[model samples]
Target: MDSEPPAAGIDVSKPHPARRYDYWLGGKNNFPADRASADVVAEAFPTIRLAALENRSFLRRAVDYLAEAGVRQFLDIGTGLPTAGNVHEIAQSIAPESRVVYVDNDPIVLLHARELLDSSPEGATAYLDADVRDPADILRKLDESRMLDLDRPVALMLVAIMHFITDDASPYELVRTLCDALPSGSYLVMSHATSDHMSAEELADTNAANQRSGVPFRLRTTEEFARFFTGLDLVSPGVGSVMAWRPGEWRPHPRPEAVAMLGAVARIP
Candidate 1:
């Protein structure tokens, strides 16, 4: 894949979660450091690559479902390196007038934002350099951009990125802050990594590997993952594995547990 010059202050010496994730997704936008860190995690949990692919699949399905449901606006936070079936692409394909805003703090992702995420003629797509932990900043930037109307319903997507936000960061409150800002008809589409399906030995090994890679991975339980949907009306198929979230004929992974990612979609009633 072609790339522009590294943005100033972008330290490629250390592995970043987004780049490591790109490596796992079989993308060529990763560096040696990212490959090494991804390798460490793969050694512990061989299914990590599958999990990443499945996570992308879940994102596409969620976007398609929301678009079909008549939610024309989307706010995708912590959107990593651009891949196929992006939020705007899927939504605009179904609804030409759909609008989407992609947010991420990574300099590399920001540098390639325009090149990878192209908008439809009738719709709009904007990229924001912001952190997920700071919802106020994100909301302010979105409002300033005028890409989305807060008064109308929007689908807030948080897929496979929440695990990086540890307990001390008050992730639940952060999520609530963003969701609370949207209208009652808004939706929350999320997918989180979990250890609930792993054996004790596997969980310990995976945690140790992630720790060694210098990336924080706080795997949650199924029940803990369900807490993210609190105060929202969960759609059918409640919280379940990523592979089982309205799976289509496009199978990305062989087994559900191999993905180890839980997903759910809910509406703000």
Candidate 2:
């Protein structure tokens, strides 16, 4: 890809979800193993690549909206391998004083963060090597970094990552814990894959293929995805297909529902 070797301790032998996603986005950071796995998924559902692009576009629009609303700090959990229009870039471009903290357990992502996620002089950016399931650890890392002010309003981004967490892990509870830790005015930006539109056979085939690829995929319903924002005020055009929320001509997906991803932005009151 970039001529840079895989970061130390990175397992290149197995296909990682982040790398597979990068492959779907037409990025060159993925290996043959990831491409092979992605090929299987593409064959099963030809729209997966489109779904990835739609989710990314949703991320950009959501961040832009948040920035316009005067939210200057961001806590992006499950921040996968960095791609275009990252949180810091979008936020800082709008307000140079914006501060962003990215969290992910992948060493390779951390290795590349310094190079790709640079911040403006007036703003700051930091990365946390932690998992989404461990809210306390994430908070502790944020506390240690002091990169963001907890008392101030921060946008907690859970985009395209929560689906990886199975129900047994108490994904809902985990999200509640993270949202609870934020201030009253903080916002929650989330996007998740769903089985609501997929047929039983399609779900079965996709799950089986994902299992073989080593990436845990759990497709939640729209209601289940909405539970993460319980007791919060949803932004306009709430909880719909990712491409339908504030759709712009930037990256148009004619049939967003076909992408099978639901997204929304809400504020914790």
* Cα lDDT listed for each candidate: 0.89, 0.87
Q: Write the per-residue lDDT of candidate 2 for residues 1-269, one digit (tens) a residue.
A: 54256766888778877888888988877777788888887877788998998899899999999999999999999888888899899999999999999998877788778854589999989888999989989999899999889899999999999999988899999999998989989999999998887788988988887777667778899988888888999999999999889986664356755699999999999
TM-score of each: 0.95, 0.95
Clash pairs, model 2 backbone: none
Off by over 4 Å in 1: 1-7, 250-253
Our tally of clashes for model 1 stands at 0
**C-alpha lDDT of candidate 1 relative to the true structure:** 0.89
Task: For candidate 1, write residues 102-192 as lDDT tens digits.
Answer: 9999888987798545888998999999999999999999989999998999999998889999999999999999999999999999999
Candidate 1: which pairs clash?
none
